[model samples]
Target: MAIIETRKLTKSYGSIQAVRGVDLSIEKGEIFGLLGPNGAGKTTTIGMLCTIIRPTSGSASIAGYDIVQRPSAVRSKVGIVFQDPTLDTILTGYENLELHARLYGITSALRKKRISEMLQLVDLTDRRNDLTRTYSGGMRRRLEMARGLLHRPAALFLDEPTLGLDPQTRARIWDYIRKMARKEQTTVILTTHYMEEADQVCDRVGIIDHGQIIALNAPGNLKESMGGDLVIIRTKEPPLVKIKALPYVREVKFNDGVLEITMKDAHLHLSGLLFMIPGVECVEIRVPTLSDVFIKLTGHDIRDDSAEDSGSWIDSVARYRQKGK
Candidate 1:
C-alpha cells in the first residue's frame, strides 16, 4: 500500500473553495512538493493531510489509517513543521524537543537520546540550552524540524519549511530532509512557493493553482516540456502578443515590461526577433526553470497577489497545537 493516498480530497471555507478535487499517492521514502503561488491552495491541502483542518468532502489516508475516520491515529503517524515559527521564545531548544517527546508519549530515556540525536541532526547540539528567541531565524527553523521528527513519524509534512530563511540555511535544511528520508526511510510531503526549492529537493512536484493541480512531474520532465531555451527581453511596452505569432516562438509572455519567449531554438530565433524589435535588450537566454513552468501553466506570476497574512500563516500551526486536543 502507498504510504499516503488521497482521492478527490477537497476543502472549502464556506464559499471559498480552497482545495478542489485532488487525487494522489505517495510511496515510502519519497519527497513530494506542492508548488504554487500565494492562495493556490497548497497550505489548505497540507492542512487537511496533517489533520489540522477537516476536509469539506472526499477522503485521504496515511499509513493505512483514514484521515477523517481516524484523525488521532493519523496524527500519531505524522509530524508537521509549519510555515511559521512555533518554538517558545523563552524556552531552551532542548526544552522544546522534550515537550514534544512527552506529548508523543516517548519514554524519558528515549526522549534524552532522541533529543540529543535531533540536535545533532540539525547541528544545534552546542546551543541546545540557549533560549530560542536568541536563535537566528535559520536556527529556529531547524529546531522546529527536529521537533517534528522526534516521534519517528511514518510521514512528515513540511509547509514552507524554509520560508524567510537565508539561502545557506535553506540548503542545510534540504540536506537534513534528504538524510532523514534516506537513513530513517521517512516519507515527506512539502509545500513551497520557491520553485528552486521544489526543483532541487523534491523527487516529484505538483503545480497547483486556483484550488487545483495543473501539472505533476519531475522537475526535469516539466522543464523538458518547455521544448527549448527561453529568450527573455526587457523593453517598455514590448509587443509580446505579436511575438507569439512569430516563427519558432512557442510561447510569449509579457510581465512587468519584460517579454519572455519560449523558443524552438534560441540561436535561430534571437537574431531575427532582436532585429525586428528595436530597443529591446536581452535579459536572459537559458532553459526554463520551475518558475517558468508555473507561469506557462498558470498565465500569471506566482507572487501576483501581495503579501499573505503572516499572522494567519504562523497561527495556523501554533493555534492547533495550543488547543490541547
Candidate 2:
C-alpha cells in the first residue's frame, strides 16, 4: 500500500516555481529517494509533504491524511530529520529524545521504552547521557535519527541526511538508516544529491530537475535504460564522425581532447576501436551509473546546476512547529 501520495503538487515563490506538477506514490516500508542536484526542488517537495510548506496547487497525503486539510493529523503520522542539526546543544542525548517524546504526547512508560530501543538501535546507548554538544558529527546525526523515530511515526522524511559527513561516516549513517527502517517498519522518504549513495541505499528514486520529476524507477532499471556502457578514450586527434558511424556506438561526444563513446558491449568493441582510431593514448571502460543516466537525459552533468533553492528550510520547519503550539 502507498503510505505517501502526491498529485500535481506544486509550490511557487513569487514567479519562481520551486516544485511543479510533481506526482508520486511511495509504498509502505520502502526507501524512496528524491535524487537530484541541490536546486532541483527536492527540499521544496519534501517541505510540502511534511506540512511545513503549503502547496500552491494539487494535494498530498501522509498515511491517509491530506497535508493541507489535516496538517495536524499528517504531522502526527510523520517525523522529519532536517539537513541541518536541530538538536539542543546543552541537553544530553537522552534528554533530547525525552523532550521530543513528550511533545509527541507519548506516555511516560512508552516514551522510556521507545527511547531506550532507539538509542540501542543507533548504538548510542553508551553515550545517551552525554551532552549533544560533545557528540561528534556522526554521533549527533545518529541521535537525531533516534529522536525522529521515538514516537514510532508511520513515515520518516530525511532531507540531505548526510550532507557534510565524510565518505566513511556517510556509509555508516546509511547503514543505521537501513537498519532502523526495517526494525521500525516505517516508510523512508529522503532527498539527496549523492548519486552513488542513492544507488546503493534507495530501493527506488525519482529524478527531479527544475521542479519536475523526469524519471522514476529502481537505480538499476534506470541505468539499464541508458542501453550501454561508457568507453572514455583520450587522444589529441579525434574521429568523431567515424565513431558515430559505428552501428554499436549509441552516442559520441568529443570535448577537451577526450572522446566519450557510449556503446553496447564495450569490451567486444575495444580492440576494434583501438585499431580504427589512431592516437589512442588511453582507454577506460566504465559501467553505466545513475550519474550517466542523468547526463544522458539532461545533456549536462548534474553538478553543473547551482543551489538556487537552498533556502533556510530547516528554519521554516521550526517556525511551522512553533505555530502549532
| Candidate 1, poorest ten consecutive residues by summed lDDT | 310-319
Best-matching candidate per TM-score: 2
- Model 2 TM-score relative to the real fold: 0.79
For 249-302, candidate 1 gives per-residue lDDT tens digits of 887877887887788768766777887676875568997788767766754322
TM-score for candidate 1, residues paired by index: 0.76
What lDDT would candidate 2 get against the real structure? Answer: 0.88
| TM-scores for the candidates | 0.76, 0.79
Top candidate by lDDT? 2
CA-lDDT, candidates in order: 0.84, 0.88
Count of clashing residue pairs in every prediction:
0, 0
Q: Per-residue lDDT of 60-147 in model 2, one digit per residue for the tens? A: 9999999999999998899999999999999999999999999999999898888899999999999999999999999999999988
What global local distance difference test value does model 1 have? 0.84
RMSD of each: 9.2, 8.7
